[model samples]
Target: MIKKAVIGVLCAGIALGIGIVIGHFGISSGPSWLKDVAKDVDESFIERFMAEVNTIQIQENLRELTDVPHMATTAGDEKTVQTMLRRWLDDDDGLDDAWREEYNVYLSFPDANNPNKVTVVDAANVVKHSIREKEKPYTDDQRDPDVVQPYAAYSPAGHVKGKLVYANQGKPSDYEELSKKVNLTGTIAITRYGGAGRGAKAINAAPYGVAGVLVYTDPQDINDGFMSDTNETYPHSWYLPPSGVERGSFNRDFGDLLTPYLAAKEETYRIPPENIVGIPPIPIQPIGFEDAYVLICALDGDAAPFAWQGAFNCTYNLGGPGFKPTSAFSNSDVKMDIYNQEVIKNSANVMGIIRGSVEPDRYVIYGNHRDSWVHGAIDPSSGTSVMLEITRVLGRMVKQGIWRPRRSIIFGSWGAEEFGLIGSAEYTEVISCSSFSLTLHGCSYTLEKQMFRLNKTY
Candidate 1:
């Protein structure tokens, strides 16, 4: 908690402080009031060097990092990590040494073909409902079919047909109510995405022999009204647009499933298929509320309990046996064509050091993830820009021999975070296994008495 709080303050302070510096000096051009304020502190050299940490530079950095989809285990992601390394190595920054620590990570994700799909048909064999299986963006970089599709990572790839079952949030209690009305043996669990992590919905349903799981975010959950209809979404406001799918991993264990509790080293033993934990065996896919509406209205059964209601226009029904299976199989079918390939690939973790003076052994680490599902302008590119600006200012201070710290600081830019916390978890595992602790006088890159350390990974 202390570390988190300290880093939060540091990030906020660095951005705000630089903005103030630019406003009072660069933009205002040292107005009479600014000159008067500078007189009190005599205008330190660090203040004069504040040009490196301006808003323009920050935006430029953000633009560069968010230019492409840098999903974990992709070439785009590698490009982003290398870009940061180049910045650190440039002579202008005046840093000591920078290197990328690589780790072998296993990842599961959809491909360029948009492999996942869902369809709903009625007993008459008429396609009553179906999703376009796509996203519509209000701005550039927000929507790209080339990006990973709206499917849960680690979902087993297959196709299944069954009756639709509206299980509310798909929690245990919701399932208990579902059991009262129907048997889940050959059902497709359709639940609104809420009340828990999106992945949990599929996990909870899998044990009941559910054929498949479909999760979608209802607009009413946004701000009490739908986007565009009542308020702006994306590019205009932060609210998700109709086609926005909240993409995320469903790894219940919360880390790399294959190599838990240990660094994913080349020699580390890997988990077998059956032993792999925290991932569901059933196919799972996420969709926008627009697509969900079609299936929700097609459902025909008892209206769900009052507490199970959502913002949908029709009553939420625990849909059923679907016209008694017209011929052989039920006409109500839910199908998924998921393609999540897993491979052992290397991820780069960039660690840039700034040696400390008095308490060199003890460390303060500043860290953030670099990988994103798409052009992650908000999730990480924004945070990455802040980290870069902070590094620029701190490097300038170190070069000018000003504002040294008593304790060593490490700046960490973690990679492969989207596929679970792969980079940091691997680093932490290595540290734990080696029983490694920061050396009191490891090596000083800045100065002998006072040091300012910075490290980053993505």
Candidate 2:
């Protein structure tokens, strides 16, 4: 019985040894099997495509384009479009054919004979007062010299100067509170930048006979330091002039050159040249607190309600001095040459196509706006470069014959997006109207959906 048991044990030990050998070979060759899996997946093509996409060139392109003041209705915007076309579409190395298309869109600016230029009144008096009282001088140059002066696109021009009053946020509630606590009629109002659009604030102040308006960015509202409570880091010091900062007209309701809803309509609606709202009747501009401090200190009135105070590190005040008329002020007139004409011409939309063996008609379209405000680095170059790099990688895969998508892949770099989504919108509308088998808008959401579909099918 003992001998029979020993023989049985030896047989079990041999079986275990063979099992161990098989497991060792399988573990040692795992990576080789993975390679085969990759080959089955068209061999790391997707991975390479993604790696090429995450390049630095993309960011540089975007920054270069958006770094300037290219408002939609300016000659500078045309230059921006030309630059975008050259960078994305006019490539000598035949990777793809990308082009820009232009559409005649109506835009307007301030009319002549408008008293919309900002002027500093009683400057001599303010300066004299500052020096006599040993206070900080009211330096107009302290704010951004190149700051895009504030103006409603279609504002009727007029001029009046009244005692300046501080209205916080300029909201309806704030206006109600002002009505109770102080008289705003025949007063020029100054409001901080928050709560609503600058146009709304100006429009609300206009009904009260508030002659002129000055909007300013408060330090408390926009932080300067990293990890600060504010949404974005302050681009410049409070004392410096506001150059290249983003300033937009929020007077969409009153109708500006580019009306939001009208921009998307089928029948193009054009505002008459004479009636476009351009600048405030009274001159308006944004100033930093350093400049605002001089204006605020000159106030001769009751102490400002606590909630109406700013981050000037001083008590706020409502100009009063017993509500008695004390001083009159006037602004120097200036003229602005605003160009608003449509030059309709042929523009191109560049496209690259990769034919799919299985379903060539089904397409995955990818696009990014190539135009910039200035050197539009962050606004577009970043995304554009990314798209370009992605195209390059896919092109390489096709060249190597290593990868082929089941559905056709179409890549495009759009133009005139900064000028109210002109390029992309036109393309979508045209393709939709035509009998194209499949065309999709390359917006953010659509891109995500296309990616998901590609993953599932590929």
Candidate 3:
């Protein structure tokens, strides 16, 4: 009885002590913030953050970034790279650390001197009609010498002339259906965008013996039948202009095209040129729907399947080997003179870090690309503008000794994203992936790789 009474008294005393401590420190919950903590930070933090974000700064950044065409590995891309480095490495307000990592990666570009041409030509080599190499000079943006002509990146440079055929979407199934009706051999396929990937449009045609491919963005798909009316397009509304040519990478693979499984570096194992696959075997080019309409209306054959019909008012047809007898271009063959060349160039990824106050080793990656098909104002420069603005505000806070993140924040201004996501791919291959806790991207480029990770082929 004495032992029990003494034990109960001691337990009561211990409980009372714990209660006093709880009252004094308010220490009931999960583990505390595991560092030299800021005081009562939650109350005003969000308000302060919102106030710090400046719209003018973001706009200025956007304008500067979109001033030129910064295709991956080009001079404009280097300018953007330097811009990122300068912003991130500012002494007064900057990241805790900043650096650039470079990799030599393979890329393809159309010749600036001899532009790729898609034209209607007679057997006598007289040109009946030619699609313009570029969009109508809507503004100085289109006329700039740096403006890359509309050509499928990674398409082989060559000249191929064949009878024109209307192949809808260019999917394997689409081709399979078309093959049942006519021979696809030695045909120049004119396919509209929207069913399969840009590369698959040409890659799917190779098995059926297609000679060349011309891809176009249709009015129904992109403009909602807004052709012949200037009032319904850009500057007037959100519709695409009739001359809008959607250029894109025509490759089924991502990462460095040269180094598949390895990090692209000064010295890495590059697959032999002959070994590369998942790209167009024949030359491919992109044209505006205006050009598409001209070529498509000329074709004469069985009326195209109802499923194959697009927004164009004319009765669509599979080719009867050439143009209709009524058409001015009746005997003219469609020729693609493409001069795309593959080059190995250096691309750099600009990286910045904010060391975590608590767990410096762990990271939360925030990234945006710096390269684009054109100026990329919407796709990346806008996203880049926001990214830079975030870093500026956060960096200012860190510099002023006001706040620090719990997990290290790494900002990536990725390069060569326009060319198969080479920069980020090499970064992942070189870095320790186990250290990454999360990654936030402004655009999605990791879809196929993710698909492959799950054992599903892209």
| Candidate that scores best on lDDT | 3
In model 3, pairs of residues that clash are none
Query: Which parts of model 2 are misplaced by more than 4 Å?
Result: 1-43, 54-56, 59-76, 87-97, 108-116, 123-156, 224-245, 253-284, 321-375, 395-458
Which scores better on lDDT, 1 or 2? 1
Candidate lDDT scores, in order, read 0.71, 0.50, 0.83
**lDDT score, residue 122, model 2?**
53
Q: Work out the TM-score per prediction.
A: 0.79, 0.60, 0.87
The CA-based lDDT of model 1 is what?
A: 0.71
C-alpha RMSD for every candidate: 15.1, 11.1, 6.1
Ranking by lDDT: 3, 1, 2
lDDT of 1 by residue, 1-458 (tens): 99999999999999999999888876646455455434444356546655556777778988999888888767778888888898766676634556788887777766655466677655565665567666875556656544666778777777777877888887877877798898889788888777866667777887787888888887777636555634566656777777778788877764556778878878888887668866777888888877777677666678889888777777777877442333322455765566666667888788776666656576666777888888877777777777777778777677677755556677767888777777777766774412224654443222111011234222
